[model samples]
Target: MTVSMTTRASLLTSLRMMVLLAALLGLLYPFVVTSLSEVVFPSQSRGSLVYDENGTIVGSALVGQPFVGAEYFHGRPSAANYAPDQVSGSNLSPGNATLRERALQEARAIEERDGVTIGEIPVDLLAASGSGIDPHISPQAALIQVPRVSRERNMPITEVKNAISSATENGGIVGQPAVNVLKLNLALDEQARGMP
Candidate 1:
C-alpha cells in the first residue's frame, strides 16, 4: 500500500523538526549559556582574580592563604595548602584528631606572631572556612590582628582599625559583618604611600 502525499510530507517535516531541535538544544543552548556567563559574571567567569592598580593580577580574593608576616592581615585557614586550583577545606569531623592538631598549631602560630596569648585568637583564624575560598574575613577576625598589622606597618593601631572598618561590609539581612581581605590589603599598601 502506498502512503498518501499528505502523509509523506508530514514525515519529512517531522525529520526537519528533529534536526532543528537537536541543533538548538545540543549546540546553541551551550553556546548561549557560555556567552551569557561571560557577559553577566565576567570576573567570576574569569576565575575571580584580584588585580593590582597597574592592572597586574595579584591573587584571587576567594581562596585563603598564609599571610604570616605582621604587615598583612591573615585570612581563615585552608586545607588547600594555599593552592588556588585545589581549593578545599579539610572534611574532618568535629572530633577528628587531624583537625584538632591543626587548630592548635594555627592558634600557637597566631599567638606567637602577634605576641599575644592563645585566648585572643579568633575562631575563624584557627578554623578553615567551609568553601576554603571565602573572600572575606569576619570582623572579629580582622580586629584581632589589627595590632600586629599596625605594628609591622609602623602605623597607629587606631588608623589600621579605621581602615578595617572602612573596608568592612555590614550585616545585611542574615549576613555577618565581613572585611574583604584583598581590599583591606590594597588599602594598606596605598596608605604606605601616604596617598589620600
Candidate 2:
C-alpha cells in the first residue's frame, strides 16, 4: 500500500502532539503541582499526620480512628471499620434490615454509654460516613459524649468541653461544625499530661 504525503505528515504531527501533551500533562504538571503543594501546605501534603509530644506520629488529622473507651470521644461508626485501605460505606439501603438493625443497636449502646436518651443522640454517631473513614464528627456529637468522657478521664466537664471546642473546626458560612475525633483525643491526652 502506498501512503500519501499528506497522511504521513498528519500522522507525524499527531504523534508529536501526543508526546508533548503527555509530557506536559502527565509528567510536568504533576511535578509542578506536587512541589507547590508541598511548599504551600506542608502538613497536609504529608497526610496531615498528628504527632505526640514526643514527636511520634499517632495518626493522620484527615482520617478517623476508632476510640471505643469511655475516656475518649468516639468518631463515626465506619462500615470499613476505619481501615484506610478499605474506605467505603456499607452500601446498604437506608431501610435495609441490617442497616436499621445496626443503627438501632448502636443507638442503644450510645444511650447506655453516654447516659443520654436515644432522642438526644446525633445522627452522625449512629451512621458511618460515606468514605467510612471520616475523621470528624459533628460538634454536637462530641458534646453529647462529654459526660462519659469527663467521667472516664476524671477530668472536669468544662475542661473536656474546652478540648472539644479546640478540636472543632467551625464550618462558618459554608458547612456545619465538625470535630476531628483523633485530634480531640490527643488533645485530651496532652491535657491530662499537663502539656501545652
Candidate 3:
C-alpha cells in the first residue's frame, strides 16, 4: 500500500511536535528555572556569600570554618577540615572511644582557654556538624567562648557579649538564639581594626 501525501505530512508534523516539546522541556525548562531562582533567591543562587567592608567576598554564611587564633571566635569542628568541596561529618558514633577521646581533648582545650570548667563546654563546640558546614552557632556556644575571645582581644566581656547579642538571631517564635559565625567574626575584625 502506498502512503498518501496527507499521511506523510501528518507524520512529519508529529515529528516536529515531538522535537519542539523536547526542546521546550529539556532546554527551556532548565533555563527558566535558573532565571527564576536567580531572581527570587539571588543570595542563595550566589551561594549566600558574605562580604567584608572592602567589598571582597569572604565566605558563605552557610558553611563554617576554623578560626585558630585566640583573637577570633572559633566555629564548630569540621570533619572536612574546612574544605567546602570535602564537606562531611565525622561518622564516629557517640560510644566510639576515639570520638570520646577527641571530644574530651577539645573540651579540655576550650575550658583552659576560656577559663571555664570542662562541663561548661558546649557540645557544638566539640562535635563536627553534619555536612560539616554549619556557619551558625548556638548563642550558648558563642557565649561560652566569649570570655576567651574578650580576654585575648583585650576587649571588655560586656562589649564582646554585646557583639554576640547583636549577632544573634531572634528565637523565631520561642526558638533558642543563634549567631552567624561569619557575620560575628567579621564584626569582631571590624571592631578590632576600628573600621566603620
Candidate 4:
C-alpha cells in the first residue's frame, strides 16, 4: 500500500483544527462567561442565595422550596417535588388522565385548605411550572392562601396582606406580577417575632 503525502498532511491539519476548536469552545468559552458573570452579577452568579438573620444560608431565591405547612406560603406544584437535581415537569399532555386526576385532587385540597371554590383556584397553583422549581406564584395564588397562612400563623389578615404586598414583584409592562413564596414566608416569620 502506498501512502500519499497530501493525504497525510490533510489528516494532520484536521486533527489540529479539532483540538483548537474544542479548546476554544469547551474550555475558554465557559471560563470567560463564568468570570464575567461573577464580576457583573455577583449574587445571581452565586445562585441568588437567600440568607437568614443569623447569616446562615437558607435557600436560593431562584428555586422553590416545598412548604406544606399551613403557616407558610406555598409555591407552585412542583412535578420534581422541588428537587433541583430532579428538575422536570410531569410532561403529561393536557388530556392525560393522570394529569387531570392529579389536578382534580389538588383543586379539591386547595378548596378545603384555602376556603376557596375550585373555580377561584388559580391554574398556576394546580399546574407545575415547566422547570418544576418555580419559586414564585401568581399574586392571585398568594392571596388565596393568605387567609390560611394568617389563621395558622396567628397574624392579622391585614398584616398578612401587607406581607404579600411587600413580597409581590411587579412584573411591570413585560410580565404579570408574582409573589415569591419563600420570601413572603420568611417575612411573615420575622413579623410574627415582633408581634406581642
Indicate which candidate wins on TM-score: 4
Q: Candidate 3: RMSD over Cα atoms?
A: 5.3
> On TM-score, who's better, 3 or 4?
4
Model 1 C-alpha lDDT per residue in residues 103-163, reported as the tens digit of each score = 9998888878776678777788788877776768888889878888888899998899989
Give the Cα lDDT of each candidate: 0.82, 0.90, 0.85, 0.89
Write the candidate numbers in order of decreasing TM-score. Answer: 4, 2, 3, 1
Model 1: residues >4 Å from true position, as ranges? 1-26, 40-44
- TM-scores of all predicted structures: 0.78, 0.90, 0.82, 0.91
lDDT of each residue in 26-92, candidate 2, tens digit only: 9999999999999999999999998999999999989899887878888998999999998999889
How well is each residue in 71-138 modelled by candidate 4, as lDDT tens digits?
99888888999999999999999889999999999999998888889877899999989999998999
Off by over 4 Å in 3: 1-26, 174-176
Error of 4 at 7 (Å): 9.5
lDDT at 186 for candidate 3?
Answer: 88
Q: How close to the true structure is residue 123 of candidate 4, measured as C-alpha lDDT? A: 94
Query: Per-residue error at 153 for model 4, in Å?
Result: 1.5
Error of 1 at 33 (Å): 3.1
Off by over 4 Å in 2: 1-12
Screening candidate 3 with a backbone cut-off below 3 angstroms (N, C-alpha, C), the clashing residue pairs are: none
How many clashing residue pairs appear in each of the predictions shown?
A: 0, 0, 0, 0
